[model samples]
Target: MTAQTTPKPTESELEILQILWDKGSCTVREVHEVLEKNKDSGYTTTLKLMQIMHEKGLVARDTSSKTHIYRALVNQEKTQQHLVNKMIDNVFNGSAARLVMQALGNHTASKEEIDSIKKYLDELSNQ
Candidate 1:
C-alpha cells in the first residue's frame, strides 16, 4: 500500500501534526512547550506521540542530531482537502451543496462573510 492508503490521523496525532505544520520543525520539548501554552500538555506525551507519528509515516525525523528534529510529512493543504472530501462524502451524502447548506444553517455568518461567499459562488458559476 502507498502513503495515500495509510489511515487518517488520530485526533492526538492531528494536534501534533498541526504544531509541526505551523512551526515547520521542532524538537519534542519545543512542541511540548508550545502545546503547553495552549493546553495542559506534558513533554513525555508529546515525545511519545511524535514517535508514534514517525512510525505511522505522518512525520519525518531528522536524526542528524541527538535532539531529533521532527517535521510533518504531509502538506497542510493536501491533508485539509482529503479530510474535507471525506467529510463531504460521508456526512453530506456526496453532495457539496448539502454540505455547504448544512454548515451555513448550523452556524451564524456575518453579512460580509455571506456576501464574500456569494461572490465566490458567482465566480465559480461564471467559470
Candidate 2:
C-alpha cells in the first residue's frame, strides 16, 4: 500500500469531526445529541468513535476535566482542500477544465453564479 499522506476519515468519523468543529468541544453525549438530528446513533457508538479518533490524532480529548471534551486537531478548511485536491488529481486526471465542464453540465447554476465564476476566471487570467 502507498504511504498515507492524508488522513481519510470514514463517514461516521467525518460526522463526529463536523460536530466537534462546529461546537468547538463537546462530550460524547452532546455530540450524540447533535448527530441524532440526522440518524439513530447510539451514545456508546459516539463515545467509541471519539476514542478511536483521539488515537488516530484526528481529535484531541481533554481528560483533565470532569467532562471529556473532544476537539478537532486538524483544521477543517485545510482537510477539505486536501480532499478536494486529491479528488481533482485522481478523478479529474489533473484537468480542472474537465471538472468545471462536468460540473457546469451536471448542474443548473444560476446566471449570477455563472457570471461570478466568469468574473473570477477573468481576474485570474488578468493576473
Candidate 3:
C-alpha cells in the first residue's frame, strides 16, 4: 500500500467528485443524470471520467455487481487544503493572510462568518 499523491481534478472530474461527495456511492448512470441537468454530456463520457478518476486513485469503484458503484476516495478537506495551498503559493505568494484578506474584501461575509473567523484567529493567537 503506497500513499497516493493528490492530482488536481479537471473541471469535469471535479463535477463528478462533487456528485460522489454529496450523493455518496453511485453508479455512473446515477451520476450522469445529475450531470446532464447541469451540462450536456453523454453517459459514456461520465463513465470514462470515472474510469480515469479510479486510475488516478481519486475515486474507489466497487465492481462486485453488474452496476459498479463509484465513491470518492480522496478526502474533501484534504483536496480543499491541497488546492488552497497551491493557490496560496501561486496566487498569493504563499501568504494565507493575503488570500483571507482578498476573500473577505471581495465577499461580504455575514456577521456569523466574521465572528467565526475572529474566534479562529483568537484561538490561533493563543496557540
Candidate 4:
C-alpha cells in the first residue's frame, strides 16, 4: 500500500511492528518470545495481533509453511514520519521546534546523539 493509504498502527501493533521491522520476518512464537522479555504477553495474543495487523495491511503473512511468518508491509521510515507529524500537529501546536525542545528537555541525549542532532540541524540550515 502507498504510505498515505497505510493504516496507523495502535500502540500494541507498533510494538509488534518494531520486532518485525528489526527481524525482517518472524513467526508468532519468535515475536512472543522477544515481547515476553519486555512485557507479560501471551503467544496467542501476539498471534491475534499479528493476524489483525495482516488484515489492516500493516503486515503480510507467509502461510506456506506449518508456522506462519509475518513481515511488515508498511515502511518503517514512513510510519515514523506519519506518527511524528501527527504528534507535532496534535501535541505541539504544529510546531516541530516545540516538540524537539520538549524531547531534549525531558531526556538526556548521549554525546553522539547530540552531535548527530547538531549535524542534522546544520544540514537543515544549509538547505
Which candidate has the top score in TM-score? 4
**Candidates' C-alpha lDDT:** 0.88, 0.87, 0.91, 0.95
lDDT of 2 by residue, 1-127 (tens): 1226446778899998998888898888899999999999889988999899888888988999899988998789987777778778999999888888999999999999999999999999999
Worst 10 residues of 3 by lDDT: 1-10
**Segments of candidate 3 deviating more than 4 angstroms:** 1-4
- The candidate maximizing lDDT is 4
> If the candidates were sorted by their lDDT against the true structure, best first, what order would they fall in?
4, 3, 1, 2
Question: Candidate 1 residues 74-102, lDDT tens each?
Answer: 77887888888999999988999998998
Which clashing pairs does model 3 show? Answer: none
Comparing 1 with 4 on lDDT, the higher-scoring candidate is 4
TM-score of each: 0.83, 0.79, 0.87, 0.97
- Cα lDDT over the full model 2: 0.87
- Residue-by-residue lDDT tens digits, candidate 3, 52-108: 999988899999999999999888887778779889999999999999999999999
Which whole-number lDDT from 0 to 100 does residue 121 have in model 3?
96
**Candidate number with the higher TM-score (3 or 4):** 4
Instruction: Give each model's clash number.
Output: 0, 0, 0, 0
Which portions of model 4 miss their true places by more than 4 Å? none
Best of the two (1, 4) by TM-score: 4
